[model samples]
Target: MVYLAEFVGTAILTLLGCGVVAGVALARSKALAGGWIVVTFGWGMAVTMAVYVAGTTSGAHINPAVTLGLASIGEFDWALVPGYIGAQLVGAFFGACLVYLAYLSHWKITEDPDAKLSVFSTIPAVRNPVANLTTEIIGTAMLLLGILGIGANSGAVSAGQADLANLFTNGLAPLLIGLLVFAIGLSLGGPTGYAINPARDLGPRVAHALLPIAGKGPSDWGYSWIPIVGPVIGGVLGAWIWNLTGFGS
Candidate 1:
């Protein structure tokens, strides 16, 4: 059930996240009225709602990065890592598929292959691999730190100060985490679109490659490694840093 929860949660997350991109970037879509602000908030709210849906059953680690980060820090059982990540990946793939079906009519009309691809995965604003990787690493590290900080000492999880520790259980944690994502998007999304979660990027990117969208371009496989590798490293790095801080202690 935990794995299933993660699957459902991540699917919802990616569905909304990609849906917003489709709305804004697709030809003649109503969301064309939107811009970067809409995209950022859309992702943030996606995270929030997904968390609410799966928080009780699975802690809602909708992103593989979150699951790995917690496991690396010994906060989660390593035995469960594979299942959680697998579920997230499959969920993300399905979510992107849903976005495709929703925008079935717009793909052929939208001539830019890049724009079509962007609906599914991240693309670096600049084409420098080193710089792009660095951006993803930094963004994901911040994400892990922010997520940990939000639930630190939460009364729902541990014995601690009653006032603040309840964030996880009290329901405000999701909104704060959502804000964290929004902040990251506004501040760090320029370089690589902040593929802070491996499942979020890789699964959808794979979908982009496999799906039969009209006039679609290549999936840019050349740049795909950074999002996966960077976030994994960043998740571990952030977990180690947070543990060193001893905030929960």
Candidate 2:
């Protein structure tokens, strides 16, 4: 059931998050070219909604990095990490598919293949591997750190207790998390588009490769590993730092 919640929550996150990109980038949409601020706010709200819906069941670790980071900090069981990540990936795939369906006709109208691809995954403004990887790592580290701070403040998930109600309802962690993501997107997203969550990037990128969208370009498989590897590294580092600091003790 917890796995199911993670899946559903991640799916919702991808659906709304990618959906905004589609609306802003796709042709004939009212939100076309709405700009970065709109995309950032949309993703932030997406995270909030997903957390509200799934926090009670799965602690709302919709992002793989979040799951891994918590495990590293002893907030979550390491044994369950695989299931959580798998569910998150599957959910993100379905969510991206839904976005494709929602914008069924727009693909043909949109001339830029890169734009279509952008809806599914992050694209760096400058494609330097080292720099891109560094940006992702830093952004994701910030994400995990912020999440740990939020959890500590809320007492939502103590050493052994994972109380969903306290996390979302009592502590308002969902709203704060949304704002955190919003801030990240606004401040640090320019480099690698701030793909702090591996599942958030890879699942949708896979969907983009499999789905039949008109004039769709390459899935950019060559650059896919950075978002996954960098975030995992960042998450672990963030959790390790938190533990060292005794912040969540």
Candidate 3:
């Protein structure tokens, strides 16, 4: 059931995250060219909503990077890592499929394969592998760092700081985490659109290849490893640093 929660949560995450890209990038869409601010906010809100949906059941580790990070730090069970990641990937795939279905007519009319692709996956603005990988690494590192930090503080409600901890407890933690992602997008997303989660990028890219979308183009497998590898590396790094600091203890 917890695994199912992971699946549903990830599905919601990609559905709204990709939906925003479709809304902003696809030709003739009302929000076409809505710009980065809208995209960032939409994705942030998507995370918040998904967390609200699944946080109780699965802790809302919708991203594989996050699941792996927590497990690597001994904060989550190694036995459950594979199950969590599988659920997240499958959920993300279905979410991207939902996005495709939602904008069924936009594909052919959009005319730009690149624009269509962006709806399913991240694309580097400059297309430099080294730089793009670095950016993703930094972005995901910040994500895990912020997440663990928030988790650390969620205990404040029991630490004689109930009023001060209200923002991190009950239901507010999700919103703060969402804002963290938004800040990441605004600050570090330009380089590679911030593919900070392996499942978020891979599942949707795979869906793009498999789905019968008009002129969806190549899934760009060559660059896929960066988002997957960089996030894993960065996530582990962040978790280790947090563990070493023992802030949550």
Candidate 4:
């Protein structure tokens, strides 16, 4: 069930992520010439929906770094980490594949190399590995920290019980999580615009390389390690900070 949830969640994420890119970057579209704002909010909504779907069973880490970090900080069950990461990556890979299929026709129409690349994956504004890596790290750290707080602090209680008067319960965790992502986009995301999820970055990146899109540029392999490494380090750091503050205990 977890695997299936991740699979569907990630497919939706890439569909939206890449779909919006196709809309904005491809020729003859209403969203063409749109800017970063579209991408940022699009991703935010993607995360929200993904979480809404997968939050209960798998916790919807969806990023390996997040699972590893939470485990390291003793907030998650270590026994489940590997399976979770594997599910996330598989889900992401399938998602990217779907994006490729969905946008294949658009690829033929788009002539711009960079824009074509944008339709499927991320690229740094500047090619400095260190700076881009740091950006990803900071962005991921912010995200994880807020998630930890939300998880630790949130709860629900039924205030009434009746046939028609029964209360529905909800937690603030999702809202806080969404706001944290929003803040990350607004603040620390400017550098690389926050490819904070390792699977989110790497899976579609692999699809971009594998897919036969015309005029596609290099997959940016030289800097690929940044997204993977940065998020892991940053997630651990965020979890560490949360633990230090006694939030993870």
The TM-score values for the models, in the order shown, are 0.94, 0.94, 0.96, 0.88
C-alpha lDDT (0 to 100) for residue 61 of candidate 1: 90
lDDT of each: 0.90, 0.92, 0.92, 0.75
Pull out the clashing pairs in model 3: none
Could you tell me which residue pairs clash in candidate 4? none
Query: Which is the winner by lDDT between candidate 1 and candidate 2?
Result: 2
Q: lDDT score, residue 138, model 3?
A: 89
Cα lDDT tens digits, model 3, 1-249, are 999999999999999999999999998899999999999999999999999899989999999899999999788999999999999999999999999999998898998999999999999899888889889888988999999988778866554644656555547899989999999999999989998999999999999999999977898998999999989988988888888888778
Best by TM-score: 3
True-structure Cα RMSD, model 2: 3.7
Compared with the true structure, the alpha-carbon lDDT of candidate 2 equals 0.92
**Clashing pairs counted in every model:** 2, 0, 0, 0
lDDT by residue for model 2 (21-116), tens: 999999999999999999999999999999999998899999999899889878899999999999999999999999999999999999999999
How does residue 67 of candidate 1 score in lDDT?
88
